[model samples]
Target: MADAAALPSEALTPPGGGPGAGPGPGRAEGAEGLFVVLGAGLAAASHPLLYVKLLVQVGHEPLPPTIGRNVLGKKVLYLPGFFTYARHIVKVDGKRGLFRGLTPRLISSTLSTVTRGNVKKAFPLEDMEHVSNKDDMKTSLRKVVKETSHEMMMQCVSRVVSHPLHAYVSVLLVISMRCMVQFIGREVKYSGVFSAIVRIFKEEGILGFFVGVVPHIVGDVIFLWCCNLLAHFINTYAVDDNFSQASVIRSYTKFVMGIAMSMLTYPFLLVGDLMAVNNCGLRAGLPPYAPVFTSWIHCWRYLSAQGQLFRGSSLVFRRAPMQAACFPID
Candidate 1:
């Protein structure tokens, strides 16, 4: 009786507690707790309008590490997995398929100018030309535009160079997610998160990766457009020197902005999610002249499910690292 009682007490007490033990269960639980907190916290901290709002109002201690990464324009996650999936678009879909979303990429790049691109820094030096006219506005404008173009070029180069691995993981993960979710109601129980990864390795061999590319391209292009457009509009219109910088207000506003963006562009992401399953990568995933409503609704349901599964850069087995400072209002 005493031994049984001790088992329950010890379980409640945490893993490595008896006065002599170091951290075992306690540490594991703490780590998981920390991860959950960080996940939510990182999302908020990297959120600019929120960060600005907090700064203006509460005088918070400081932003989280993710926020710092955002300001510095460095992506925190490696997501070594998804990049592998990128190759499938190249290998199976051919050259055009590999770069399927070029138009969206261009659109994303142009919209990016509003926030991170700051191409305005060049063209409209009228706002701050008095501070330093040592450089001509045209020169400044040229440089900024050139830099923005260069950034886009750099991304393309990187994608091309790392095409193989990126294709592999990305393709596999996308298909795997759709499959697992469909398999959700069955006895296999969708294999949980960490194990889903391991199971991918065991079951699909090295080839499970190509399946994820189409979904990734779809999700990313739409996500970029939505996120960038709203952020751009907010900065261009809503944000200004006076009231726009409030941290709490900005934080909440950013959250809402992200949500609005999500809702608006979610269907595209949904289509991407569904199309990811058919990723032999041989053809463009979308069919020509398909019934608009059927495709859209189909995309929406799948996307909604996936969104619930991987909310805000959060994914189960694979993840997209928080991108560069996406929406910096004012």
Candidate 2:
């Protein structure tokens, strides 16, 4: 998923007044800290949903599908929704279990945020000028293109620098032994984070830490370019400056556009997550549950063929796949 905090919608300017001055150094630092804290808090709060989503993505459906009605009021077999799936997790491992693998995720988010900020500071945009809608259409368009290009460049550089941390987190939380312990039937191997890291290194070596990074970076780049370009065009051409709620409308536009673009790029994320876990020693990554993918391309092709690219995109109102539904429920 795209990190809203790291988006280049607004440039980070140094303290004091300029054409479009940003917050001062101390204030900026404090704000970044608050962002990290709030981000971590949100991650902790939403961990359960993500936990269930990951399991579902890996085809680890411990609970059977239940009868439910769709939005159309048609009767259908629905896989366990968030509450049902979460309740099962609580039953098996208590409330604390819902937070499994959260530590690495939090750390990852914080590191990414900090690293991006520092990198941006190190390579600040030169002659940073705010593009005004008041300017002539051709001039505004030119400025927007220039600014957007700079922003995308900065985003790519920051992403490359910070991606190792992201990869590490994916290793620990997506397909690693640490995350597998959250599943009910998986055998407990490594007891904690440090031990799990050591074991992965011993078995899979350094490459193990970077399993799903390529697709992830690609997804982020695609998302950033699409979302940023579209938002700039809308805000520049579509939204009128004289409108009273112009800012509000533009904000909503960016949010909604980001979501739409995310859906389009979601398959990249799905493939990345699957590759991270594939053939990684857990049953979830092994045969019957999943095939031994030679590379992310193979995984992508398999998922595309199975029409399971968006397997865990929705948490609530999940419908079982036809093949899964055909199997006799225990």
Candidate 3:
């Protein structure tokens, strides 16, 4: 009877009983917990939008008209732009074509989200509570700036930690069947994910894995900061402070806010995507379409030279409405 009573007390007591050693740190607490979080995140990150967005961005490059003879020997000119590329994807690979690079994207993005969340919790910045209704415009702007800065810091930290996965994601995005055929030509094809991975490893070695990290990190920071600021603005200015249990208004506000955020940040996303898959031809064992830009500045410079830096901005804006709603819906 005494041992049973003591057992309850012991279970409730801290390990040190002094202060710090209560429960273990929750950040990736154990191998099981780590695996579970990563597994769940991996599944969640395999969203169709991942592939769609990448494809849309990659298809921004204008393809030359392919001249061929029809059944009657008539001249047929096929030009591959965004829509044509999308059609080719569907015609060639069917529905499954839309899911190219899902595996590596799932892994990279899941790890990024998890790591960012952990880093955010561990190294919190200025509390949002300080920004109040009574604050002046300048004060409010300052608060938003702080919030954006905090988000960027957290994202950068996570990006570095997940750099290898990020590089793999970039490589996969570039060499995925849809990208390989549409962006390059049908001549170069990856057998599947495994073959693509091995091919990258052998061809470029370790540094190859870090191929597009710089652009990705830069784009991620800018997008996150802008999105968070916009969301904060909407939440503060647009949303009602008091709400009942089943608040349709709040839900709608969130949905609209998300869509607006997606649209606003898309240009930066275009730059990132361009830099990311910039090496697609090289990765496919063909001559690279453009010289490898060593940094974000170089990438931007190259794009600016071609006058196509904002090539996919319209497509991204058009897709933002559906893409953004997925966030709040999920």
Question: Which prediction has the highest lDDT against the true structure?
Answer: 2
Q: Candidate 2 residues 1-330, lDDT tens each?
A: 422332332332222322223457877777777766776787678767777777777777888888777788777788888898889988988998787777666665566666666666776766534354556657766765776666666666654544433322234433232364336444565445576667667888877767776777677777766776787778777888789988777666656777777777777777777777777666667777779999888988999999988887788778888876675543
Candidate that beats the other on TM-score, 1 or 2, i.e. the better one: 2
- For residues 103-194, write the lDDT of model 3, one tens digit per residue: 65555555655675577558866444434353564787787787767767776776665555533333443333223334235434445556
For model 1, residues 102-134, the per-residue Cα lDDT tens digits are 222222222222222132223332221111143
What global local distance difference test value does model 1 have?
0.32
TM-score of each model, paired residue for residue: 0.31, 0.83, 0.56
lDDT of 2 at 179: 65
TM-score of 2: 0.83
Which ten-residue region of model 1 has the weakest summed lDDT?
1-10
